[model samples]
Target chain A: MARSDDEYDYLFKVVLIGDAGVGKSNLLSRFTRNEFSLESKSTIGVEFATRSIQCEGKIIKAQIWDTAGQERYRAITSAYYRGAVGALLVYDITKKDSFDNVQRWLKELKDHADANIVIMLVGNKSDLQHLKAVTTDDASAFAESNGLSFIETSALDNSNVEEAFRSILSEIYRLGSKKALEKGSTSNFAPNATQTIVINPPADEGKTEKAKCC
Target chain B: MTDDKTLFGVSDGLLPGRVVRLGKPVDWASILKASQDRERREKEKRDSSSSISDLKSSQTSIPSIKPKSKKANTVIEESSSPTDGETETGKQRTAARENSSSSPSATSSEKLKQLLAEPTLNTEAVRKLAWAGLESEMRSPVWKVLLGYVPTNLARRNDTLRRKRREYQEAVNQHYDPYLDTKEQSVVTNSSTYNRIGNEEDVTFRQISVDIPRTCPGQALFHIPEVQQALKRILYVWATRHPASGYVQGMNDLVTPFLFVFLSEYASVKDDLSLLKATDLSVFDNADEALSNAEADSYWCLTALLNDIQDYYTFSQPGIQRRVHFLRELVARVDGNLCTHLEDEGLDFLQFAFRWMNCLLMRELPFHLIVRVWDTYLAETDGFATFHVYVCAALLVTFSEELQDMDFQDLVMFLQNLPTESWTNREIDVILSQAYMWRTIFGAAPSHLQQAFQASY
Candidate 1:
């Protein structure tokens, strides 16, 4: 379920989607809770956890959704795309197949997801630099062409894990706030859409949503 | 069937693991009865799905939006079971089964008929054979797997034990040898050590492998020939329905009992083969074979399931750790209060919960007694959550009376060995029931599994 935690300024539904063994769940575990399980079970369905962080003076509650990667499970999982604000399209840098499968995953998102879902290309397991298949330049360039934010991370070593999530959240938040300012008292918020929009915030733009009711 | 070398004289190449002493033998008729009952139940379940579909159609007019994006929502990590809505992708694929043109989902009787095909002592049937190590072929298949895993070296090293095992084997040989004048047993030996043994007794020593199963009961159909036959057919139907996970190594073990009970419909055989084939079989994925997967994929998931809780997987399945970690901490918490309590009591969580962790109280309980456990478990998915807590509370309460007098070690041993008794004893049931009611009232445990069903998509 999408959250609207009235007390918080922002509610972000962030999804971790990637290849079967690219460590999407691990990244979520590391960023949201700073914990990891070496022998985690193959996720059967969907799992969720929430953590709120103070970003730019607003308590941004990141409602993270972790999903199973098996091809068949997708039938049951596709329904979770409703109202999601951010999608983490992850891949294992060490394995090329996972990197190659990214496009299929993207197509999956495009087919059934909200049109304006903000996606980030995350090349995870960066610690295996020697076995790296997908390079930062290649991924970032792909991200540029596809309009996704790209970053490399190693959940085990905790390298840039937080930054990747933070970058995506900031991008989503900026988009959300700028969206509020542009709509100018209209009921439209871009969180439900699938396109990327420029968020040029006027100093106090986001405060309007919370203050308007008051 | 091969009469000499293990079956038509064909050697299994690998001497299959020793059998577990679980008792009795697979009663082909009883199993057939259970199979029939299962077919009826499945038919009823299939019948139920229509109303569910009617309900679902009204509620969800918009086909689920399956974006090509990676993650959709927070799903329970352990979702082999199909949802009530029956739209799980795995199910859809299996329902589109090519092999079973009639579709097991469509007919219950046909599924059972195929399941009851006379057992051929092939590699698959050889798996069902007994070892003197375990009492009989009647033991759960998983137990046979465990007995087989007992470190082969240990069996070879212990001379006294080897002698006892050999004597027991000789006894069984004598009885089956046909020239025997009386019941053959170890007692006729020159020494008295063999006299302590009985026909029903099984040897006790270190066990090698013990992966615990999900706390859901093994298959629990009832006892009637037609019903049993129907269920056997359904088992095969289910197997064909999920061809990828078809006939997995350990599945027959977990499924046998359910197949057995469902077979006991005690009603007229429906002969509804087409309807039986309609079952959706995609949702299940076994951790062992993860069946039909490329070795790479199977190893990948199996490693995930078995690797952590590391040693637990070495002995049992990984799910054991979720509660064992909690219980271990709980033991530490209580014992920390008084080292003397731990020292005086002489308790250790692993030894106590080792087998419990290995088989989830299933192995420890007799087959017949498990029906009640299944009844409760099927009613709720978190049955284990409730069961584990009640076990903790009961262990505490049972010993709470003599809390100070008992040494921690002795207490731990008692707790560890408690489930291995001849019968479950009333306390375990009382405690399990209490936990179930308490949790039902208190609210289900706050875990991903609880909120999973209602999650979006």
Candidate 2:
């Protein structure tokens, strides 16, 4: 499972961040492993998992980093945001406090993450409709104002979990391809620049990119 | 025996004359049944007239038969267990009798009993004995002294325990009661009010509640309602008292080893905690005083542990950062090739070693091995902070060959999910011995590691 796969067309590093008990870890597991446990342990440091999804006719391997959602963990978790190309800002629907903390989480990403990192504001735990405190309209309006893509997912019922990841990966792929095109155009555009658009490609390119980012 | 050879085959080069004994393959079903039968007999005796004498005789005999066989029994229960209802009384009796005579665990239990029985507890002697490894039956009281939760003088031990336990209960009432009662109302109010008013008590309570059920998700023990409530109260009380570090995420994992060890004091079967059913925990429900005592011990021991490594959970967690740095340098000095291989693959020590230092490898190893590891950690001079870096270096070096062959992603995943789920005492003994050897070599001369790193470059 550790071996690098040459088969992926692109690899996007995404992060999951939110307040405590907001289902960030469950969302990561539900998306990456198609597994969910009601009693999943709170992520202490950071957890890493990878899954390949078909997006825009390309295999986009999403390397997801799940972080502890406690406020104090930002000292360590913020570093993981440095090179992340995307982020899933998650919040529980039943808990108004988690949803209200979305603004803080967004400011956190703005502080630490890349300027162009694609973000999707995810209102999770849609399964608990009766106890819901945050409405879809409020979260949607919040996402729109912040210029982030929006989705409501239930990692428990497997609702919109896959689509949530697919949309974000596809958005990242679009932005990455655009960035590669612009870079290629200025530096004597090659005919095969499309094939070289893999984000943080392995070997020579991977080494330099890692050194620069990390 | 052949299976044991293939399973825990690694030799401990650091310790001489330490024979790693492999008892006959454990029959968990019969053992479980035997334990249950023993519980029934003990209960029947308690209802009878001669309960005290029978209890004393049974306690002495049970430990002799139990410590060795039950040690192996827990490893099996943690990893995999065979089907029950297969009565092998003959084989079970033979294995139990052979284990009592042949297993070193029995002898260690005897030695610990004698040492702990001394009027004035010999602190150094107990530390040395416990550093080797603790038998399940002896862990509770041994840990109480080792962690200094109980006084060394036997005359004052009970008084000290009563006072500390009462203080803990008071702290819980002062901090946790308001949160429990006003939890819904606080949620109804804006969360911004919490930040503005500096009422982190609500936030800390929420975090602890979320983490309690998640503490040991796989184990039924933590899932018991009483256990979960106790954990929440312990963590919440501790966080409230220590404002500087106030309830970090990894502190939840630190409490489990203590709770498991201390709670064993109340169980009928001391060796294998896995045999304990949720129904058995009813004792705690009925005897509220006993339950509170265990909770108080867990809280105090956790406080004692975190007191030594307070910086690890402080704002920036500088202690863990420094430890991770030291681990990297130590690994480079110990195994330059593996260190270079990791750097070449873009693997930073913080990427993996942070969790190792944070949870003390509790996340990587299974519950049984973690308890065994803590037997040594609590015995360390600096309370496992300085010595733990050496252990982390030893663990990395042990996997040097396999880690060198993997890529960055593979390395992180492999290190995070180490294949130690099925590890028995044999593997743990080797790792602890290796950790001790490295600590002895590099622990005294701090400059030796720096000089070694510079020379390698």
Residue B237 in model 2: lDDT: 77
Q: In every candidate, how many clashes are there?
A: 110, 1
Clashing pairs in 2: A2-B410
Task: Kindly list the per-residue Cα lDDT of model 1 for residues B1-457, writing each as its tens digit.
Answer: 1112222111221211221122233444544454345434444444333222122222222222222111111121112123344323222222222123423223323322332232210111222222111111222222211212111112122342233234323433432222111212221232344344432211110000001111122322222223333323323322322223222222223443343232212112222222132222221233222111112121121212122222322222234444555554444434444334643332334334534544445444555445434433322323333345444533544455455554432343344345434555244455444443433433445544333322311
In model 1 chain B, the worst 10-residue window by lDDT is B203-212
| Candidate 2 steric clashes | 1
Q: Residue by residue across A26-138, what tens digits does model 2's lDDT show?
A: 89889877899998877877778888877767666777888889998888888777668889999999888898898899889989777778899999999999878988999
Question: Is model 1 an incorrect, acceptable, medium or high docking prediction?
Answer: incorrect
Using DockQ as the measure, which candidate wins? Answer: 2
Compared with the true structure, the alpha-carbon lDDT of candidate 1 equals 0.42
- List runs of model 1 lying over 4 Å from the truth: A1-7, A181-214, B1-457
Give the TM-score (vs. native) of candidate 1. 0.37
For model 2, what is the error of residue B290's alpha carbon versus the real structure, in angstroms, after optimal superposition?
A: 2.6
